[model samples]
Target: MAIDLYALPVTQVSGVKGKKPEELLALGITSVGQLLDYYPFRYEDYTLRDLTQVKDGDKITVQGTIAGVPQVQMYGRTKSRMTCKIVVDSLFITAVWFNRHFLRDKLTAGAEIVLTGKWDQKRLHLTISETEFPGQGKSQTGTLQPVYSITGALTQKWMRQTMKQALLQFGELIPEVLPAELLTRYDLLPRKKAMALLHAPGSLEQGQQARRRMVYEELFLFQLKMQAYRALNHDRADGVAHPVDLPAVRAFVRALPFTLTASQKQVLAEILHDLQQPHCMNRLLQGDVGAGKTVVAASALFAVVKSGYQGALMVPTEILAEQHKRSLDRLFEPYGIQTALLTGSLTDRQRRDLLASLQMGLIDVVVGTHALIQEDVYFRQLGLVVTDEQHRFGVNQRSILRRKGMNPDVLTMTATPIPRTLAITAFGDMDVSTLRELPKGRKPIQTYAVTPAMLERVLGFIRREVSAGRQAYVICPLIEESEKLDVQNAIDVHAQLQFAFPEYRVGLLHGRMTASEKDEIMRQFSSNEVQVLVSTTVIEVGVDVPNSTLMVVYDADRFGLSQLHQLRGRVGRGEHQSYCILIADPKNEVGKERMKAMTDTNDGFEIARRDLELRGPGDFFGTKQSGLPEFRVADMVTDFETMEQARDDAAELVRRPDFWTGASYASLRQFLQRENIFTGDLLD
Candidate 1:
């Protein structure tokens, strides 16, 4: 019988005792298996090199004999410097160590030593970052040394020694989680051999090979769990097969004031096709802002309601909900399709009356915020559910809304375009449909990035635009002055603009205001009562003012690329030419890149790809909200090809009848059960 390395504590290792165990625990390494799995974030090459082959300012590792006793000089209260001379290949070089007075006794005359650091060929000097005696227990001089992230007085030397001990004792006991056939098919290293190579590799190529194996393993496990969830959802028998009336739906589409774009038509066709399937529709509908997604969604709701079933549209904010309800009401008016709005701000009596109407099947469709998912809210034969701006809501919130009916068909919509790599990993379980074409006759917004020195000119442009009977919006990052950030706030900007343009009406809006107050301010802005509206990012999503042609964003460097694109989207909605002026003085390369990307093109997909590369997957959409998993060795950006292959393999394997019960799959089943991968819902 094999011992379970995962159950053995870190103390069971030879030298991981006393404070060492506590230190290891601080890094979340409680068991022997975990300690081994804590792979290095990077590696440092300490391969010994010849002095003749080294150049000036080259980082080199060399072994030599100390020519003299080291001397230590104390400076200030606790700072000290040690100097010594060493002979490498018959060339004398002075080595310096800062704040390492303890090494003075260790470096005696004629002692063999290994030093690694940058060399200054002109001065024959080396600033030593590490020192190792030639006869040390295990030398890392001629190899790639692993660099681990440490804390609590733990040194790399101690970590390497303890890891060698753990591997020597329990390496063979590391069970193989993947099947043997898979190992041979992919030409991957065995689990035990890979673990050993990760800690102590002979060369960079060897370490990369080891890392490839781990990356494939992590991605395979993630895909397997995603495929299992998809299978479970597909196998459900309680799904409602909503009716798809193409003739009626097309007629409704034809009656709209504007013609539907080719992309919108294709997406609506996909949604209608899913409605007739045996299983519920789990699909993601994504597009850039002003892509006409609402009209496509409205057509789907019309089909469900015409078939004698109800539909629900859930948004993120009350303002958005109200906007949807008003638009949906106008669209459904010709056919006498009734629509109602529900929000947290509704009165108790009004809420009770609406709930009663919905339960009694009197309401054909309802649009709401999170109020749609409350315990008291009920629906009569809800056949379709549409969530707008899907990323704003949590997974549980969406799930609760689906629970209102018998596995109703779901259509999730987002204005933020997600890259193909992220779409495959983060939303792998759902089928995706993208809308890339905007409506006809829509013009691109002219964008520019300017420094604070151009503030007066920008204000003058706004003044001219406003004097032409148009409105403008001035956006800030913060609601009030924050001690930590030096960016402009909404209140101060509003005050300044009000003073600068005494003849115009300037209004302030932020997240700190009440819903009704926000509604009133927005109402004023929409009606052109407030010509210059100074606000924060609270107006990024649903506030649409076609008359507002100018958008001036202060401290635009503080926002992400996607966010800036969204702010730029607020304008360019009307027929008149619009402009977006970005006021920023970027201090870093990434900020400069963002500014360039914004001013270069108006394609949201290109902007999204750049954002993913600059900010990485963790901050792309925010890891928690994005539903992206934290991997041990795999990176979402660099390892996207591995992820794609893993997804295909998992999909193929899950279709096998014996995958869940075969003896060859016992290890995978055990691993999944131990990790609790299947216990939770997908994308939660």
Candidate 2:
């Protein structure tokens, strides 16, 4: 009997015996299905390389016949090298292999062979990493060759052989999961055909079709899952009917220190509208740093409290929660709305009092970390749930908090700017409102990319700023020493900067510090007690100080463009003209582009676009999202239209029981399960 494709291990397959199983496991290739998902990252067009056009330093592939016996050169007893001469139609090139003396017999005269490696122009030699011969039955020029990510134990030769075997045996059994309508609309190939073409295409064009099919499949299923979530959340019992217009809430908004920007006013209005809806409100509020997201969230929370209901705000870190507590406490105190703080570091008595107040409706609003989702914490009449930094928490975590009450309105906020296309795909289930404009009275920070040669001049500038009654933030890429990465860290930068500014106060902040220690350090920095705060990315959010006027980021190239923008935003809040100095000597072109983007514009959206284009969507979306699935083929920048179509199709499918809730959707269900997406969980 043949084995099942889903459960059959690579060890059970032919040609995959021996230590290949262990090597395969290192690449997450345990089961046949997983092995199939491990498609080649790229392919080498060995079938059509012209030997005449091959240049030095270029990676090329060529097919030729052995013209003579191989030469073995020995250096010492343990070091040996083998060299062979191969000829094409009228051209000849020397191929070299290191430490493979046994290959001499295989290089006999007139042997047809394929070689792929770097071409050394200086010696006109090809340093071959892969070689295939017709006699061995491994070299086939008719098929485009696959190049995959490899480990030392697992080479491309073995991987290709194993994948080929798997496809030949199981490809026929792979079911068609996409509906016929979608297949016709998108011109996609059947699943089995796509697998065959993608794993071992006879031509490059066929491989392209396979790629489109796979990308469509990934984004299609992902959008379906997101649409299902929206449907489930919308179908839930009506949420709290919080009153939006109340005397206290109106008064609080009028009393705000600075006028709300046009973007903020629009988003605030949208939030209030969502709160008035009968169904549960699921919305994502996005903006750049200093875009007044907190104030917008505060306004919504105020409306909830004014209507005599409780509101909860969850942040990524304890320091951020504490800062929100202080900021909101001050904002709502005049409005007579009580606020409480709950975090992991809170004392037993303090937590007890807060929980008790929450249950009794004494605490109108609560700002907390993940502790807000604990089973023990209960809300009196939870009307709204607001989360800062939406990417830090998944939809389930947000739902976990919402489940504590009767379907509370969910408003998630993020300081990072997501591209419009990404916003649709990632936040498809929720209404999105963007705040692109910063609040009034905010000064733009000047950014400049500097090399290490200007370190002295930058330090002198910081000294001048501090002496003029302004504080500075010096950010490092790492907290402590990392053996793998040779980058500046907070501790070393702290010691060096302390010496640089002996007369001024220099404090250090990193992730290794305890909650109280970080809070105290931030407090000192806020009070201008620490003129220079040499910290890691710990101050990425909510370390707002109007007096801080300068930011100096060491190794700025190590950070993403969006992150660099966030770090630059720490300063420039005050009325004075601010400056941001980025000390970076970028090694690669991408790093150079990131530094240039930071110094070019203050627009977060533009930075995000550049970051997406430069790093590709994979790295940009990895940590920037929590529950979103990683795409293997579909790029948001390239497949924007496909993503949009998938979004529409998925939404329609969810409304039909014949597809969404039936056996036809079984494969999609399995895919979502693997992606860790469940609409039932969101219905909670």
- Candidate 1: stretches off by over 4 Å: 1-35, 48-76, 80-98, 101-129, 133-139, 148-165, 228-236, 347-363, 656-663, 669-684
lDDT of 1 by residue, 280-341 (tens): 88899999988988888999999989878999999988888888898899899989999999
Q: TM-scores of all models?
A: 0.87, 0.88
Number of clashes in every candidate structure? Answer: 0, 0
lDDT of 2 by residue, 1-684 (tens): 444576877676688877888888888788887888888889877764775677778877788889978899998986788898888656778899998787787787987888888888777789987788766664565557888988868888778888888888777767777877788887899888988788788898899999999988888887887887776666555676566785665677789987888888888888887887777788889998888899999999999887778899999899899999999988988767889889999899999998998999998999999999999999889999998887777657777898898878889888878998898877777789999888777777889999888989999999999999989999999988899988888999899988888898899999889999999998998888899998999888767888999999998878888788888888888799999998887566677888888878999899989988887766775554465556766778889888988888898987887765677677666766665556344422
Distance from true location, Cα of 89 in model 1, Å: 8.3
Query: Candidate 1: which pairs clash?
Result: none
lDDT, candidate 1, equals 0.89
